[model samples]
Target: MYAPQDDTTLLVDALADEPLAPGARVLDVCTGTGALALEAARKGGRVTAVDVSWRAVCTARLNARLAGLPVRIVRGNLFAPVAGQSFDLILTNPPYVPAPGAHRMPRGAARAWDAGQDGRLVLDRICREAPALLRPGGVLLMVHSALSGADPTLRLLRAAGLTASVTERRWVAFGPVLREREGWLRERGLLSADDEKEELVVIRAERPV
Candidate 1:
């Protein structure tokens, strides 16, 4: 299982290379260990982190404290906790797994994984709501699977009135599919049994100035 802070290093490295304006307001949705939010704070942004899982919020709070970063960690689903709050920068690495037939997630995995059947539940919602929560000229950075590809995501972002683009990509082994799930996926033509892995796509979109 991946740790809550699994992608902290990569996210931090990216942000460090592209620093936000000083005193910028930032939000990290699905802030699984507060890594992005804390890192943003460290870089001089006023940061707020939100997550659906209570445990994740607690862990994120502890992580911020341990890292000596002052980030506000809130427990709530998606943008609900920060309704009417807009920010200069928003970042998220949401749950993006396409599990069709699974009745329930493996115990501990629910907090970090499980997108919808097409792996777009959280992603779609975020895209739809992001424009409203971003100040004009603000940016929204999101990391998700390339399995669904970038076209649809870009289309969604545009429809939401934001300009979007692929910022980074990395290919990684997603592991074997369960036998029954594999058969199901093949029937739907979503995947082949021989397919061994997938790619992760990081995208960044910006609200118009």
Candidate 2:
């Protein structure tokens, strides 16, 4: 059940409101359905959407064509597809699931959901790499779980040498929680079996000009 979530629209609206400079270069990492990238393109940014899944990349390309926008859809893990290139803005909605062990992700879901044990695998990696890929004065916006929340994410960004902040937030209930080693999680008080829903947090960080 890795459908396009409402966070896509939320991120788009935020970026649009910022009024990105015309012709700015933008990157949308993990661009599942390409909603954010397409929206950025519509707002006058040269958008490039990258996904590790070939299928997702294809879907994004088709969606861009259908919407009559020129979005470059690339297939590679994180920044792999955009090596040697930097952007004025970068956006991502990465998989933030905290799978402690042998967790079974749904077919095709890994491309959209399935972070490492603490749900920070992709997020951490992105933060670590974003600064190098961002131009001076570039911005990065990401949507993740408030379960993991903004604190850890912002810490990682700062550690990566980027100035960061939480730009927006919204409450969303995505049904049951899925994690490997329930007893272990409970023992550590990280999660409980009875927890039915969780929160999502959207954060925006920047590379200094």
Candidate 3:
């Protein structure tokens, strides 16, 4: 499982800026360690966290119990388990690293990151679907790598009728996976040979009231 990292921190920090009404319903898609969900619960929000990995769900459940927080944990692809439900806020830190070769969607542990080439495989889907999961005047906060095209995210969210913008950014050094794929990234002209860091961003979108 991908442990919490800079992208996670960026989203958590952005969540703090959101005006979550007391007992606001919150959803955390692709929740890994349930870190964001736990935080929302701590903030007095009713939180639900879902992941494709059963291990992730179990881990998140355990984490919530250990933390003495009430986080509903489910194992399913994004939005499936929460069908017909609306939340005041939605948060995600999905896989956004571009992979080599045919860019087939990843499974297992690799599913935590290995997004297909251009890194929009999951990010694009989230942008298109997440807005529907929000209650009117609700907010969605997503974190992704700059290589995955932040502009497309904003464009998609806005087209979906949400007021969207980048709220936070941070430059973080390449992690192990990125270091291993550095050569292929350069070959694809996505990165330069000397580039050792990547900028992660938090895109926040709000539905019209």
Candidate 4:
């Protein structure tokens, strides 16, 4: 299971501005440690959290139980567990690191952030699938690093017929993952020598009523 990180914080901060009413249906995809789901529950939402990793599912369920928050934690690929169900809010912090191979079914710790090649493998799926999961007037909030191309994310969301924009951005120093792959990132022109920080972004999209 991916531990909560800077990207998680950005998404959580964005959620604070969202107006979730009592019993609002909220889905947290790729939920790590159930942080987003728990927060939504605390804010009066009927929350469900899903992750492909069994460890993630177990950890999230345990966290929700310890927090005494009523979250429906499930183990499944994104959107699979909630088929035909729509939500008022959808939150995700999927894998976005530019990893080595095109390994779709990532294993071990790589499951946390081993997005293949350009780092949009999981993100693209989310974009293509999220609109169908949202109720009319529902909101989707997602977070990732600028290296993953925030513009592409906005474009994808817009193409999917949602009003999307980057709602929040923060420049954070390179974490261990980025630092370890610095040379490779430079080869791909995703980073530069003077680039001391990576921009974390929270993208918000709303489905039309």
Q: Could you tell me every candidate's TM-score relative to the true structure?
A: 0.87, 0.87, 0.97, 0.97
Where does candidate 1 clash, by residue pair? none
For residues 128-162, what per-residue lDDT tens digits would candidate 3 score against the true structure?
89999899999999999999989999999999999
Give the alpha carbon lDDT tens digit for every residue of 1-209 in model 2. 35576667667767876658999999999998888999899889999999888888888898899999999999998999899999999999888766655265434655366676677778888888888999998989898876655798899898878898887877665534443444555675666567655556678888888
Ranking by lDDT: 4, 3, 2, 1
2 versus 4: better lDDT goes to: 4
Candidate 2 global TM-score? 0.87
Off by over 4 Å in 1: 1-10, 102-108, 175-187
Candidate 2: segments with Cα more than 4 A from true spot: 100-107, 176-188, 191-196
Alpha carbon deviation, residue 147, candidate 1 (Å): 1.8
lDDT of candidate 4 over 27-141, digit per residue (tens): 9999979999999999999999999888899999999999999999999989989999999999999999998667556778787888988999899999999999999999999
lDDT of each: 0.78, 0.79, 0.91, 0.92
